[model samples]
Target chain A: MPRLTARERREGYQREYAFQQRHGKPFFPHVVFHDTIVSLIVVALIMGLSVLWYVQFGAIPTDPMAERTGGLLGPAYEAKADPGVLGYHPQPDWYFFFLFELLRIFKTPQLLIVGTIIIPTIWMVLLIGWPFIDRNPDRRLSRRPIALAIGVMVPIVLLTLTFYGSKVPAEGGAASTEPGAAAFAAGACSTCHVLANAGTAGNVGPVLDEAKPDYATALALITNGQGAMPSFKATYTEDEISCLAGYVATWSAAVGTTPGPGAATAKDYPASCEKAGGLFAGTVSSASGP
Target chain B: MSTLLPPPKEIAMMPVDWVEERSGAISFGKFMLFRNVPKDISWLQTLGSALITVFILQATTGIILAMYYQPTPDTAWMTIQWITNEATLGWLVRGMHKWGSSVMVVLLFLHMGRTFLFGAYKYPREMTWITGAIIFILVMGMSFTGYLLVFDERAYWATIVGVNINGTAPILGPALSYVLMVGPEIGTNTLSRFYSLHMLVLPSAIGGLIFLHMLLVVRLGVTSPPWSRMEPTEGDV
Candidate 1:
């Protein structure tokens, strides 16, 4: 169909105005009534959620670690912010799950901007500029196939991203009794690399489960650093590095399976743990009991 | 020719008439209340008003929260704990604010989707859509800034990542990151910065844009559902 001229569009709108003036209902009783019902529903829903969240929160736990373990709506609050500890996984609220998932897709340093800023910015620009871009005067859904398809596609894509984002494993590792495991969790390793044994799922560096680096490779990389991965040499002692490297080598390939090629065995962990001699030793002694 | 004492109804309406006479508010109120909307408008059209309602709830609850919320690192968490565990109905206020934010976002997207699918953004309503779009971005900004106000572990780390994401945006990335973080780290300044933005800056901007958006809506009038069979013909009247 030929595009409507500016004059035609204006006239069309004028006719619409006339028709509405003649046949439409008053905003006071008609539109206001619908709006009032919706507004009331929204208020009730918010209040209901608040009450549900409050009632579901069982008594606050005595254990600081378990404090505010919220109910269905989620906890009233989580553990206090401790910047010194970097082991915690960062998750945004549910609304941001789509962007959070975007970070996972564009995990590489080179493309991080694409996910973080570029894509979202472009989406915003497109959204704001849509009216100008789609100059077609047709408002009928059946008549505007492109608009209809786009309208459907955008929500589907966003919902898919949000679903995946919500499913992304928490990057924070579980508490481990093993000396090497403790060291790996305490150090900056959990912030970048995903190691299943440590329960970390950081996307900034290689997923150790997939990489399965041997002791020597893990040690060298940890000491020397690589692109986007910082060197730990300045921060960690040689022995501490060995303990971390051993931990990675032992667990990166997965548990209970023989590590591939030159990987450190579980037996090597005690020696590295002894040499590291701080948090590692503390964990070792605690694990051994008295 | 009127009697010394006005009729009882006029006496009762005296104050209202005086104010209306001075400000023309009564006429404007009448215009707003009595205006005609397209006959085919549906329940989906109420989403916009619903969004405004949620925002008003957020603002109210947020004010209640800010009364008790401490912005400093040392006391922020403690205050949050106090509000949730100690203050009467504090949990309810905070919970509503927390949950209300997500609701507002959901309603925002739904309203935007309705406008898009209905082709309500076309023609004279273009400005309305643009203003609404800006309001959408501002609402997201409000969300990002508000997340850190809780000052919990998750809030802190998420904000760290959030600021770092801002730092990834080419030439202005570092500057943006610096402004948000106020330094190399997320410290006292960062929390206060987020607090200011969340309550003061972003909310005001969104409120202003929403006013413009509503003005456009009232001016252009609501659209007829695109699928309605009652499409107005030019010569039908």
Candidate 2:
């Protein structure tokens, strides 16, 4: 082999070093630079859109008290403030709403992790790093089965989860007088219980709203265990049994509306106890579960 | 001129076993030094290696982080705080997991893209590609489910979206959902079900699919360099 001069050797080293830096994908490929620029532009556009909404449409001030704080900078702060805005009802934006919906649906505190960190973490890894992890040279749609499957399945799953989230009622936000009642309606009381807005049409047990039984009658059925309505005396209390019986009876007709000669005051619950001849009406709603 | 090349070694050759050569010596040094290489490898092969290394990182950090995390609503956010503040290097572990997931998804997609553009999905590699796709879907499912575990406001609301979607099937929507949540409330049953699906079912499915995907990859042989394909040999293989 021809012997290389010292200069030639140094030149070779420089060339090799440059090659190592670039990894042979064609030097400064325009696609790389172009992709980077496009990404940046998109990000900037989003920011610009937000800023435009704030500046041109005029920002809704966040705090009115800043002007009265006794400082020169206070007015500027107050100018940027739109006081008494509870911040749009404490919700995330559309992009993150699916997750937010998930949290709402996940009523039980114990299963929070499934939807929170674990699933999101998996999605990020799979979506961002899939190409790196599944580096194959196949180009055909049929041959690259994993890619095709993933391509389709991911959207399906995300869409499905999103659907579920949308349907689930928000938790703890709008004051659920009794959320578990919905759960009971889901299946437990489906065959035997009857709630109208619940859309339940069970024919087995006496209609909940129609019962309109007083606290005494309710206590007797719930505690002593009426026919078809099993005795919940063990699982319930004189008070709870009384409440549950009242719950069913109220749904039938307003509770304590005794059509008999001896009835409690309709004078107290004018709005609540209104049953001249009507039964209780189930007030528990199914429209609150996420 | 027709001497027949000495009858091609007629010493009772015993029909040599093809498997014998594969049983050669193996050691860490050999792999690192490329001692057993067929001398035809190139930079394109590095993608496979990178995938494996990153997967190991994901699994290791994921397990470690999970040990301290509390999945329940009452403690989920609080537990994350502890991981960040109380546990030694817990933030790093959690961050790695978080970042690692993003990185993995990006890489996996790229890998799939590479395979597609290169036409590596031809012939014997079809199953491999399919398996990879399944794994990718699983990855997404895991991600969506995980968001709920944080027990934050967003997660709470998002699950409603999840259920409604599940309830979309033709006849079984409502009933299916009722069974899925195990009593229609966000109670213990729902949490346990989701947790089991996330930790056990999904991971295990992913693990199995990964193995099959890799096996198919190795069996099919790394797609030859693009240049090599252009310069077709007489034997084709």
Candidate 3:
């Protein structure tokens, strides 16, 4: 070959290098010097944030596993009042949401596992095995039917499941006691809210110790309104309000009188929390009856 | 086959519009170069690289701090303070790790989106795409478990949210979360659980996925130029 100008020689070198890179001649995107720098920056940043959240706002949950055994949401033990990530439950961050929402669609509260585990596993399998199944060499997005469907479906399905998960109410099974009775009162309601266990005597709520204020007087306070106490008029039906008051007034008569966190010492509040029915036992039964 | 590598230079004299592309047939220069590589790759394309950088930083800082950090509430905050106030480069390492996580999450997200929009997940490279997705998920899980290890308010609440949601899990949820987090309350067990997960489980998954993702990417070749398939708009004039 005849000698070429320096410029031509340089161009040829550059072109050759470029061609080699494209043909997979040992050129790796990740092995570059800058890649090392970039990787350092990224890994450092993520790890740093985690540590910051760890050091500054990580959570040491008062209830790590969900053992709110009794009523009253458990005693809160040693709650650390930091701005930890645990409290703000948008979810397992973004990646898991699509799957989080999936279990929710199943309906049963206990079925959340299907959302977190099974669905995600299935999704992973589908995603990983997708290439083997879809052998088309076409890169056009619109033409790759299987790929297109998967691309759309995985997120859509995952997202749908997450939306469903979000909608699910926080699971709670403490169960409202008393069919027609003010079981809360019988459930040691007087200790906290004050509705007359054995003549309610606590400042937690407007004291109901005074009386056996007949149905009408009690109705105004319990149904319409009371201090620091929102009215139950709307939340409870006329019958419920009446029955609640009577249940409160007589629970002390049947049980006794005591302050408590859950069921007011059982003795202080007649009937076990689980047995207290919600509806009225009899219309003409107690004087607090509506 | 023979290329001389020049020392790093601050080429201010050359035209500002062009990237610094030297050609002296240097040995290392040749190894570092791309032959026929697409020209469009830019700073934006370096997001994955950036993420990997931050992730490694996180791991380094985290391991160092893990040496001194205590999980108990009474000792947790104090230990952290001790690390920051007493330990060596504790503050910088911790701070970098903290900021590093945020950067990683953002870069990974950006990287994933780029992959999706560029049709980088096509036939031969689908595994790479999938591995990237798994890395994204693992990053989140790492964030989650790691947060609990920190044992702060946000972490506490986040833990509650975790537990509450986990409690919603089917069958053995209440029991499972109990076992995972080590009981119904934040105690020694909770810290241990978080610590193990943060240091071990999450990292392992992330490591494996990253390996596979990188392998596939190298094998498939960074996507080429669309313009290559067509005639050059201006042939060397």
Q: Considering DockQ, which of the candidate structures 1 and 2 is the better prediction for this target?
A: 1
* RMSD (Å) per prediction: 5.2, 18.7, 15.4
Chain B of candidate 2 achieves a TM-score of 0.74
Residue by residue across A189-231, what tens digits does model 3's lDDT show?
3332334333333322333433334434555666644222323
Name model 3 segments beyond 4 Å from true. Answer: A1-107, A110-114, A145-290, B1-36, B81-96, B153-179, B182-186, B225-237
- Across B115-217, the per-residue lDDT of candidate 2 in tens digits comes to 6555555444567767877777787667656655554444543453455444443367557656766754454566667667777788889889888886675
- Candidate 3, chain A: TM-score against the reference: 0.37
List model 3 lDDT by residue over B1-237, tens digit each: 124643335345343314334544354455445533344455556777676666666788888888898877667755755564457767666666655665677677578656654566754566687788778777877877766665544456446555645555457766866776686556677887778888889898898888787666655556643223422333322
Model 3 chain B: lowest-lDDT 10 consecutive positions? B228-237
Every candidate's lDDT = 0.79, 0.47, 0.52
Which pairs of residues have clashing backbones in candidate 1?
Answer: A70-A75
Task: Evaluate model 2: give its TM-score.
Answer: 0.43
> In candidate 2, what are the lDDT values of residues A1-290, reduced to their tens digit?
23456586456545533433233232123323444454444334434433332233223233422221212211111111111121112233233455655554432324444544456657656544555566543445555577678767766676676665444222221211332233334432333445542345543345555544564565565564322233344443343333344444433343232222212521222122122112211233223211
Candidate structures ordered by lDDT, highest first: 1, 3, 2
- Identify the leading candidate in terms of DockQ: 1
Per residue, candidate 1 scores C-alpha lDDT tens digits across B147-228 of 8888887887678767777777888987988898897667799889999999999999999998999998888888988875
